[model samples]
Target: MNWYVVYTKPKWEKKVAEQLKKSGIECYCPLITVMRQWSDRKKKVEVPLFNSFVFVQLPDSDRNLVFQSVGVVRYLFWLGKPAIVRDEEIKIIKKGLDGTDSCEITIVPFQIGDKIALDSGPFSTQTAIVQEVNNTHYVLVLESLGCVLKMKYK
Candidate 1:
């Protein structure tokens, strides 16, 4: 079996990972705990280390099974081929997320329209879809009322 990256629908990483495991597929979805603030209180929440992506261990023969899994969009391709994730790289990711490595957390490249919550700040726990990303900051829109929030993290 080889490690492959599966791209999932927005915010579906955790659900997809659980579904894959329930289907007897070997998979890894790294998560990190971060402080979330609400107007009333603060709490720790688990978020995907890499948004919308899950790592699965399977042979080429099982590709169809993964495709049929819930929330799976497609396999990530590079250079016109399926990108194979190395075992060592997976280990590194685990270590990094585990805080056993120099980096404490991993932030995947996020796209506009991506759903996210503020990890640390006065406005935490506010779930919003990304409308813009400019370097370390983001413009997010609260879906219900179309309110906008601009946040920056160092």
Candidate 2:
């Protein structure tokens, strides 16, 4: 079996993954919990590691079943064919996000000006740009709101 990436409706990755699992399809939607602050208090919430993407481990015969799930947009394809992802790569993602509370622990490569999103807290689903970088800390510039946030990353 090969792992394939399916694009889901915005903010629907977890729901689609759950529905796929109920139908006996093997699905993996990596998530991370991040601390979010509101005026009242602080809380931790789970969010998708990759927005709008869910990984399904399936054979070619089961491809259509994934499409039947609610909120699935389509398979991510390359050259008109579904792209195949390796088992090891899936393992890496699973292990990385398993118990993390901060995004800084991730080694996923990013460069200046790269846009990323806040998955939890008051800024849930907000997009921001990477304006600076370092091993332990960095700066994120939220352009739409005209705010600059300094965050720790390690």
Candidate maximizing lDDT? 2
Tens-place lDDT digits, model 2, residues 89-128 = 9988877666564465556766899999889777778999
Where in model 2 is the C-alpha error above 4 Å? 99-154
Clashing pairs in 1: none
TM-score of 2: 0.63
Q: After superposition, how far is residue 80 of candidate 1 from its true place, in Å?
A: 0.9
Q: Provide the TM-score for each candidate, comma-separated.
A: 0.63, 0.63
In model 2, residue pairs whose N, Cα or C atoms come closer than 3 Å (at least 3 residues apart or on different chains), thus clashing, are 36-121
| CA lDDT of each prediction against the hidden true structure | 0.87, 0.90
